[model samples]
Target: MGFCNSCGRPIVKEDYGTNKDGSLNDEFCCDCYQNGEYTEPDITLEEMIVRKTKEMMAKNDRLPETHATAITATFIPGLKRWNPEFQDDYKTL
Candidate 1:
């Protein structure tokens, strides 16, 4: 018996079909094929609260949400590296 990673349902080998990557998986399950009720990406409570707070404050101030959201986001080390547009405009090479 194999358990579906996405749905937690116990599936028999005969019920499962091979995925393109060759993993034995079910053909009919929503999680198996991403048909419905997808799981959200894992986020910590701290991250969740910060995102909401920034969005809320931005709304009250009549400014775009990214203002506060960017501040919180830039503190996350490697995440800042991913945003090339935020790089210092004056720095050359």
Candidate 2:
């Protein structure tokens, strides 16, 4: 199964976001996208990494902070929403 390109959440059918025409946007999650718009348009990639790392630590206390941060650093940049060109195109979309 794939993950949400924005938040790294597992991409289950119910978690999918809607396109402008109300079709499923397979690349994003409902939390990150709604009605073809980013929920937090101004959030930067660094902010997202920091936020997700904190979330990981909160969800699993046993997870080390360094490990969470490392994972976030590696994963977030590669996600479609955070990719350099994709981020630019997303704003236009």
* Candidate that would win on lDDT: 2
The superposed Cα distance between candidate 2 and the true structure at residue 7, in angstroms, equals 1.3
Look at candidate 2 and tell me the lDDT of residue 20: 86
The residue-by-residue lDDT of candidate 2 on 22-88, one tens digit each, is: 9998898999999989899999989999999999999999999999999999999999987886768
Tens digit per residue, CA lDDT, model 1, 1-93 = 654443333567664645556565453233343323223446443554475456557567865566656644444322312235645641552
How does model 1 fare in lDDT? 0.46
What's the C-alpha lDDT at position 80 in model 2?
94
Q: For model 2, where is the 10-residue window of minimal lDDT? A: 82-91
Each prediction's whole-model lDDT (CA): 0.46, 0.89
Which pairs in model 2 have colliding backbones?
Answer: none
In candidate 2 the C-alpha lDDT for residue 78 amounts to 91
Model 1 worst lDDT window (10 residues): 74-83
